[model samples]
Target: MGFWIYMLAMDLLIPLIMTGFGWYFSGRAPRKINPVFGYRTAMSMKNQDTWEFAHRHSGRIWKICGLVLLPVTVVPMLFVIGGDEGTVGTVGGIVCGVQLAVLIGSIFPTERALRKNFDKEGNRRKDGQG
Candidate 1:
């Protein structure tokens, strides 16, 4: 039980971090563009506009995914409360894997949006120009 609880806590880390950062980024992403931090990508780094757009776009996705994953993560653990260590560990691992998939997967939509809104030169497209 103790180990199960510990695993639960550890498994919760990703969702919590995602949610927290999502909330922060959605509202107040870093003000400046730099190579060191924030959502860095070729398209997103094209300019300040792309940088801000990527953050807000990705942040919104992360916030929603994190909120949905919270219950998804917790419900499975409820079933394994008294299970063996191996069972608990396996379930926990699967949940964390999903979280990681979601975290990495968010990049797609953000990149797509960037491509749609901005050209290779980072210039915002006019309506229907995409």
Candidate 2:
């Protein structure tokens, strides 16, 4: 019981934290170069324009992913709370894995958006300049 509760709390808390981070950072990400904050991919860091675009895009992705994950993480808890320890653990592990997958999955769309909006030289594209 205690273990299940702990797992449930952790599953809920992590995604909530991710949502908060995404919301806060998306709105407040710095324009200047910094080592510790914002999205720092090679394409994203190509310039100030790319950096800002990447963070803004990725921020939205993170927020959406976290939002989607919050309820998903809870579903397993409701179903497995009264089950045996092994079932609880398995469900908890699977939920956590899904959350991790969501986190990783966000990168793809963000990078794709960045590429769609900007060129390799980090210049914003006009209408159909791909």
Candidate 3:
């Protein structure tokens, strides 16, 4: 039971949050590619090959992780929560928090670095015109 909430958070809610995040970031008012602004690294690739390649690669990884984590973690949690027969507020809360921390901290920084490197250009000085 304790582990189940963590599973649900990591496998389900986090991904859903990420999806909403993508929408919010992509659907900006000006609709510009501001990687640093949202940590969303929307690479404006005119080349179809490069675009398709990136989609195939990074998209595939995200998909696979979702596929694996969903059933292995989330579904069981749904069952556990539905069952609801024990003290699920204490240990579960702590574990769930740790799971969230690990997931967010691990992926956010790593992806931030990746986007900064592969998608976004380096920061130009304010005194520009070079």
Give TM per candidate: 0.95, 0.90, 0.36
Q: Please state the error at residue 5 of candidate 2 in Å.
A: 1.2
Q: Residue 80 of model 1: what lDDT?
A: 99
lDDT of each: 0.90, 0.83, 0.43
> RMSD per prediction, one decimal?
1.1, 1.6, 9.1
Cα lDDT over the full model 3: 0.43
Ranking by lDDT: 1, 2, 3
Best by lDDT: 1
Assess candidate 2 and give its TM-score to the true structure: 0.90
Clashing pairs in 3: none
For model 2, the superposed segments whose C-alpha errors exceed 4 Å read none
lDDT of 1 by residue, 14-120 (tens): 88988988998898668898889798999988888888988999889989988988998999999999999999999999999999999999999888888889989
Question: Candidate 2 on 55-84: residue-level lDDT in tens?
Answer: 777777778878988889997689987889
For model 2, give the 10-residue run with minimal summed lDDT: 121-130
**Candidate 1 regions off by >4 Å?**
none
